[model samples]
Every structure is written in structure tokens, then in C-alpha cells.
Target: MNTTSRPGSPAGLRDANRRRVLDAVRGAGAPTQAEIAGVTGLAPATVSNIVRDLAAAGRVEAGDEVRGGRRVRAVRLVRRAGVVAGIDVGHRHVRVALADVADPAGAVDHAAPPERVEVRADLPDDHGVADGLDTASRLLDEVLARTGARRAALRGAVVGLPAPLDLATGAVGASGVLPGWVGVPVAGRVAEHLGVPSWVDNDATLGTLAEQRWGALRGVDDGLFLKLSDGVGAGLVLGGRLYRGPDGTAGEIGHVAVAPGDRFAAVCRCGHRGCLETLVSTRTVTAMLEPLLGAPLTIADVVARAHDGSSGSAPARRVLADTGHHVGVALAGLCTVLTPRRIVVGGELAQAGPLLLAPLHAALEAAAVPGTVRTAEVVTADLAEHAPVLGALALALERCALAP
Candidate 1:
């Protein structure tokens, strides 16, 4: 048999196809053989053969994942052993995740899907800066040990705080939110505990980062990441990068009024009446529904009731729809000003899914500038609750690449 490596030769064509399969695996969102075939324009059988050969040689790992209520084969390129940490400090809980980051110098983005040895932990939202720092430090050590990755392999850690962090001053804003965290250098504290460099940013901003890199907002240069959890917040991804303004308050859309004249409007934490945050946060929306249901309901309960097939699901869904309507009202002005290409609705309430998005879409269509609604799309977050932590990991890898 001829063994010439020319592109027209059988061996060369197989090699080229194999390379295409590898490239597809390295790209974002192409995990299954069918997906790889779509990306590389290769036959499904050809992609499967390449994947099988790669797995046999230990160049890739194949696993099963459930998507759309079905099992699919997912494949990923084997990566060199290196680790990074992402920490999410919520108002009432702390979540830490450790992920493997491949060589940053690779041409394609290094994909860090949750690993088989994936390790995540929840720590109590301890009070006081010192106590939180101490607990976080201990948890990082435990996580590293559990993953069997040497602590020395850690490149860096990125911490996301619920409160806004001024990129210029390295100070926490929204002092009333995390009062104990005020005036504290959270990144510095994390660095001390992990004995490695650390970076910090607002949790919502991190969510934006994660989504743009790996989730629904991927491939879009200008987009908005709207998080509607305990409080309302947003992160702007403009020019393919997170656009934190000079004071790092660029995406503070929450304080903008969306219901200025409504009778239900209340004073917001920012001392403003009818602010979007006052109307759309988990607390406010649930409070609005509790009276209708004749009982106090958590955001989770509302989401559960809104998921269809539940008794009286309409009431819960109506509450979410109303909240979405207000959010869309606020977003209309934002769209008019910034003209983002897409809006990813995230946070706890996003779990309500279509119940929220439908009304949001309807409101945006009715209120936005004549052509504005056509330019932007509103959708739920693909990363869902994990966006911040994954985004922290993405930041760690990116910053490490820039390190001298």
C-alpha cells in the first residue's frame, strides 16, 4: 500500500480528517460525534472512527451526557494536568469550584467542562472578614487534596463577590449588601490563604464572563448578562470583553427605574423609588406573590410551581411573568442606549424559564425602539447557576496566560 502523506492520498485524507475531528473537539459546544461532524463537515461515520482511534490512543476522553432528555456521547481532548479555582461568595452562601485548565497558549480556547473528578463545595456564609477568609482557605486546601492535584499546580484563583468591586480602587461597593466585607481586600485575603495570586470581581460580571466564554452568549461580541437573584444586577460584554466602567459600576442597571409611577413601587436599597431592583429581585417578586398565594413563598417554591404540571401553576407563572415584564421595561431603555445583540437572563428565577422569557419578550417588543427589539434576543442562561464559578475559572486561565 502507498504510504505517501500528500493531501490527496488515502493516508493523508484520514490524517486531515483526524485533525478536523480534534479541532472540532477543541472548539466550543461540539462534544458529540454528530456535533463534531457538523463542525468539521465530515461524515458521522468518519468522525466516529476518528474519535474511536483518538480514545484508543488516549488522546481524548469519551463520556455520556444527558441533553434534552436523551443520552449522548460527549468527547473532549485530553489535557495536561493543571488546576485553577473559582469562588462565588453569595449573600448567604459560598461556593467553590476547582477545574482543570489546559495549556493557555493553545490556539483554540481551552474548554473546562465539569470534570469527572469535579469537586465543588458549599460553605456557610460566615460573618466577619477574618472568619470567611479562614474558612475559604481551609476549603481550597481540602478541594485540592480531594482532586488529587498538587497544590503547586494551582495557577491562580478568582473570587466573585455579590457586591460590586471597583476595578480602579480594588474596593467593594454596595457596602450595605455585604457590610462585613466592606473595606476588606478580598482577593488579597484569598491569595494569602491559597498562597497563589488571586483576582476578584463582581459576581454578576463573572456570570457575564462565563456565559460569553462557554454558554448562551458565546460568539456574540456585544451582549448583556442580567442576573436576577437576591438582587438585580447586570454585566456588559461589549467589544468581546467585559466592559467594567471606570468606577466598575458600568452595569448597575438595577438602580435604574422601571416602574416609576406604579402604585406598587417601593424605595430601593439605593434609596430610589421604582428601581428595577426593587421590582425584579427574588425577594420583591416573591413578596408580590405571597399575598396572592396567601402564604410566603421562596423563589425556589415559585419556580417549582411555575414549571408546568403543578397544581395552580398559573399563579406562580403569572408572578414570574409580571417580574419579567418589569425587567423588559427596564431593558428597553438599556437596549436603546447600548444596543446589545443578546440578553441572557440568569440567576435563581431564570429557572422559571419560559414563564419569564415570554413576558420579557412581549414587553421588549412592545416598548423598545421600533427596530431595537429586532436586533436583540432574550434567552435564559445555559450555564444557569454555575456561571459565576465557571467564569472565575475562565478568568484564572486568562490572567495566567498574561502573567509574566
Candidate 2:
């Protein structure tokens, strides 16, 4: 019996439509049948039939939920097999998360979405790839134990690094920016250790993927996700997809010169002076206040002081606002070139909330082209610290199809 069918044949058309429905649910988190229909442009009855078949096959869970005061049938993916992993290797911490994988062929009888969990582990101020990889492996084992899944149950992993990463060779692409890990095939090593299919990208780029799928960039075709921490970096979502340019470093916006006058005078790690990163990073912001307080300070400490709402804290708040102004100045140029619809602010500094955003917005208004500034709305990130890891998970789900 032949199963193959021509593209125009009824069976082929049905398979294509079923895929359309699956992609809609997988990408949109959980959406009502009506919303899925709207996205896929499929008739409600066809969507209902495909969804029912899928639910029967243990690929998704469907239920009645209230939306806008009316009950609607909503659907979401359910994990039926092994777990997919997301690892975020930041400058000073490694955060990891896992979610259940979808059943590829109705192999399991499940009705609920898979549970998800994450853990963050701190590293010393300076550690190399070996230390980071060891820390990540231990956390993976710990989380796997919590899920009652053995190491063999791991299906796929995606790593997000805080450096320019070459996807083809799975190596950190640049030097000076991330000295300890430079030129290291960190992604390849992770994949070898995990014994599973794996992928890697810049941590900021992953943040962009997370935002597009689950946070501020949802339904946005053109947007940016910025991680403003010890250093500045950006994730670009152009034409509704993550764009890494030709060499996979599209959003290294921190090095873009933002300071006035000579761009070569202020020394940056990249050997450039007056780079945006030299001025607006977490360390730079805290350095400004450490003198007045007569003590060492972290960005988190500065943000806490700014939020305490005391006269003593006014200086802290003012510094953050000023930092935001500098950030906005650089973004004005970015907005001019990209004309993104939205810009999401993440990282530890974004914790300052309006203290950072108000001035940031003001600076953009003062600097950016009037038409471009109005086209982009700067907003705080929704997922916060968890975003990069989630983005890795999103990438894994897409690349591996969560099938195994």
C-alpha cells in the first residue's frame, strides 16, 4: 500500500494543514481554537478536527478557558517523552531550564502540558569554559533528578553564550570581549558531554528569540531585545525572525560609538574608546556612585537604593536615569537604521524600571529622528533573568521538533 500523495492531493493537503495547526499552537504558547484559526487562516471546523486528532494522539491538551468573559476552547502542547534543555551561560552565572518533549507518534497517553523548572548557579568573578561547563552539567543532573528522569532521557540542548558564537564551528567567535572563552568550541563540548543534539547562539540573541516567542516581541515583526548589564548587547528580530547577519553577530550594539567627539580615546575591551558599553554598562554605572558612598557597589545594590524611595537614594536613582539617557542615545542610531517596532530592555540594570526607561525615552526623543523614534516603543522585558534560557529552549524545540 502506497502512503505517499501528491502535493495537491487531499491526503497531502491534510498533512500540510495539520502542520500549520501544530506550528500555530507551538509558537503562540496556548491559544484558543479561534485564535489559532485566525493565525493559520484555517476554518474553525478544520482546525477543530485536526486539534481533536492531535489531542487524541497525545500531542496537545485542549480545554475550555475563559477569555474576555467568554469561554473558548484553548489548546497547548504536552510533553510525552524525554525533556528538552536550555542553558544560559552569562558573564557570572549559568541558568538552566527544562521542559518535556512532545510525543512524535502518539506513543504516550497524556492530557496535560509538561511541567517546566529552572535553576541558576553563580560562578566566580572569572572562570574559564571548563568551570562553566562543569557547573552546567551538575545543574542538569540536579534538575533531571527532580524530574525523575535519567540522564539518558535528555533529548536536546541549546546553549546561550555571552559572546559572539560561530554556529557552524560551535566556537566563541571573538577575543577580548570574552577572554576566557574566546576561540573555545564551547557548544561542541556541551553537545559531546550531553550526548544529545545541541545548538548555540549569543546569549543576547537567544533573549531576542525568547521575546519573540513568549514576551514583549510577540506578534511583532521587527523588534530588538537589549541586555543592559555589566556590558551592553542586543538581539535583533527583523522581518519576524531572529537575524544574526552574515557572521552571526548582528546585534553587538554595545560597541557602537555613542560618546561625543573622538571615538578612539576612551579605552574599551575591544580597544575602542567612547564605545557605548564603556559608559552605560553596570560597572560604569556603579563606578560613578562608589566614590560618593565610599564603598564597593554592585548594580543590584544601586538598583535597590534607587527603589528605596528615600532622600538618601535620590543620587542612586539619578545615576540610573542618566545611564538610561546614554543608552537611549545609542538606541536612537539603532532605531534610525532598523526602524524596529519595539525595543525590550532586559538584564540586571533594567530592574530599575522607569528610573532607567524615562530618561532613556527622553534621550531618544532628543536624539533620534522624530519619525523613527515615534515608530519604536521602548519597554521593559517580561521574562527578566529567565529569558535567555527560555530562548534556548525555544530554539531547541524548533530545531529538533521535540520529536525524539
Candidate 3:
């Protein structure tokens, strides 16, 4: 057995084949040798040999499984060694998730189905900077404990703030949805609390990443992700990469002033009047429906009511439709400028479904250039509320040095 490592040598060929097989198993979740062979475009014998070697080395696990009514040896990446986490900080709440780096499931590309990563949610986000970081740290710690992984097992993390991030400083930009977080080095702060390296980006940007990599926007090189939660913001993907612009505010569409009259304008979180956010945000929707509901209302409450057919539900539906129209009006300008191939709508208010989408689509078509509107697809996000967190997880896996 010559141990030469040159490309033509037996050892080199086996090493390359081993990598191909391992990648297939990791991407396929529980692919059999035959399945791995098909995915990796390798011979069945070669796949079997590589799987056997990897299993013996504790890099992968194999078990008997049934596929298409046939029994086969199912192979999957081992998870005992390490994991990564993604944290999403919204205007209303926080969400966290953990993923095994070796078997990142669907975090990478279309090669494999994504794994069912667990997420802990509903951690409040109304607190000041220090308190918000503390809340995020506690939630992350709780998720790690629930998964039974040691703190040291956390390879890295990605924090998604519902604001524009100044990439140069890792701080929230001037128009951050959470004012208290302005100028705070959010990624560094979260990293300090978690005792691990961390990275950060806008929540909408992460949502776009998740959709492009795993959800509805897959394969779309030029796309837009519109997040309508506490506020209205956007994430852009141009030429297959996220476009953050010179100041990382490229997609901060929420702060763009829309209304003309000061009397008609409502002050936004960023201190601007008539911002797209002031008209279409969850808070704005709730405020508009309060008079009809005769009580304080939440976005969820409005969405739920809008779905009902009762006369009382009429007001809720009307308000949501109006908000959608405003959002569409702003997005029309964006579509004209960016000319994305698709626009995926996500965030809390998007749960209103057709009640919101229909009006938004109508307004966009009315405002945008006919050619642009026809070319741009406006669709609901497939990942729903979990997109940002999953995007964060993908970010961690891509940036971290997790041993697999």
C-alpha cells in the first residue's frame, strides 16, 4: 500500500471519494448507500466503502431504514460532538434555535432537506439594551440546556436584529427599530453573553437568506424579502448575495417617508413622520383597529379577526387591507428601483394571508411600472415566522469553525 497522497494515487482517490460520500450523507439526512451514490454521482460500491469507513471513525452513524418500501442502511451525520445557534431579536420578542454543524440538514442549499431544528420563542424584547442582551442570553442558555449540550459545545452564534446593522461596527444603525439598541455593538454584546464568537445582521436580511437558501426564494438570484412585523423593512439579494449597501441600510425601506402632510403623518420609531412603517407596522394596525375592537389589540388579534366573516370582523379586515395597500405603495417604488425577480412576504402580519396579500399585490401593480410588476413575483414566504432564526443558524454554520 503506497501511502502517496497525489491525485492519481489510491490514497488520494479514496480521500476525495470519502469527502463526496460524507457530504452526501450529511445533505441527505438519512440516505442509504444507494441513495448516497445517486446524490454524489458515485458508484454504489464506492459509497458503501466510504460509508463503512466514516461510520467506523465516528464521523457518521448508520441504521436500518425503509425507503420506498425497501429496507436499506440509512446514513446520517453524527451529532454528539457539537452544534451552532441562531438568535432572532424582533421588536416584540426573541427566538433561538440550535443546529448540529455536521448534519446542518437543509441550512446549506437544495442538496438536502433541512433538519427540524428546535426553537425557543416568546422572550420579550421591549427592554433596554442591557436587558435585551440579558434576555437573549437567558433564552440561549435555556435552549442549550434543553438540547442537553454543554456551553462549550456551542461553536458560534448569529444574532438577527430587527434593524439596520452597521457592519463596520456591529452596531445598530441610526434607524434601528429598537431605539435603545442604537450604537450598541449588538453582535459583540451577544457574543460576550453566550461565551462564544458571534455575528449579526438585520432580521429582514436573515429572513431573505433563509428563504433564498431553503424556502420559497430558492434559486432566485435577484429577490426581495419584505418583513412586516413591528415595522416594515426589506432584505435584498442581488446576483446571489445579500446587498447591504454602503451603510448596511440598503433595505431599510421602513424608514422611507411616504405620507406628505404632517397632519396625516405619524411619528415612526426612527423619529421620522410618514415612514412606511408608521402606516403599515403591526403597531399601526393594532392602533387603527382599537376603536373597532373597543380594547387594546395585537397584530395576532387583528389577523385572527380579519379571518372571521362576521360583521364585526369587517373593520379588522379593512384596516389590514389598508395597511397592505400602503406597504405595496412603498414596495412598488422598491420594485421599480431594484427590479428583483421575486418578492417574498414574511413576518408576523403576513399571517393575515390573502387578506393582506391581495391588497398589497393590487397596490404594487398599480404603482409600479407595468414591466417591473409583471416581471417581479410577489408571494408569501414558505418559512413563515421561523425564517430569521433559521437564517441565523445558517449564518453561524457558514462562519463558525465547528468541528465535525
The numbered model that scores best in TM-score is: 3
TM-score for candidate 3: 0.82
Task: Score each candidate by Cα lDDT.
Answer: 0.76, 0.80, 0.79
- Tell me the tens digit of each residue's lDDT in model 3 across 1-404: 95446777886687667667766776666787888888889988878777777777666888987768987778888775467888888776778788776665334655332453455546454556776677777877787788787888877889988887889889987743677788888878877888888899888888888888888788888999999988678899999888888888788889988885786578777877889988888877887878878677877788778777766599998998898898889888888887889889998887888888889889999999888878777788998888898888878876752223
User: Native-vs-model 3 lDDT?
Assistant: 0.79
- Alpha-carbon shift of residue 39 in model 2 (angstroms): 13
Off by over 4 Å in 2: 1-80, 103-115, 260-266, 294-296
- The CA lDDT at 383 in model 3 is 89
Deviation (Å) of 27 in candidate 2: 12
**What's the CA error at residue 333 for candidate 2, in Å?**
1.3
Clashes of each: 0, 1, 1
Runs with alpha carbons beyond 4 Å of true place in candidate 3: 1-21, 27-76, 111-113, 116-126, 261-264, 401-404
Model 2, 1-404: lDDT tens digits are: 97665688997798678778877886777898888999999999999998988787667899888889988778988754567889998777898888777632221112222246799898776578888889999999989988888888787899988777787787887776777888888767888888997888888998887777778888899999999976689999889878999989888888887765784557878767788888888878888888875478987788888878766488898898888998998888888888998989998887888999989989988998888878678899987867788788877766554242
- Relative to the unseen true structure, what is the C-alpha lDDT of residue 199 in candidate 2, on a scale of 0 to 100? 82
Clashing pairs in 1: none
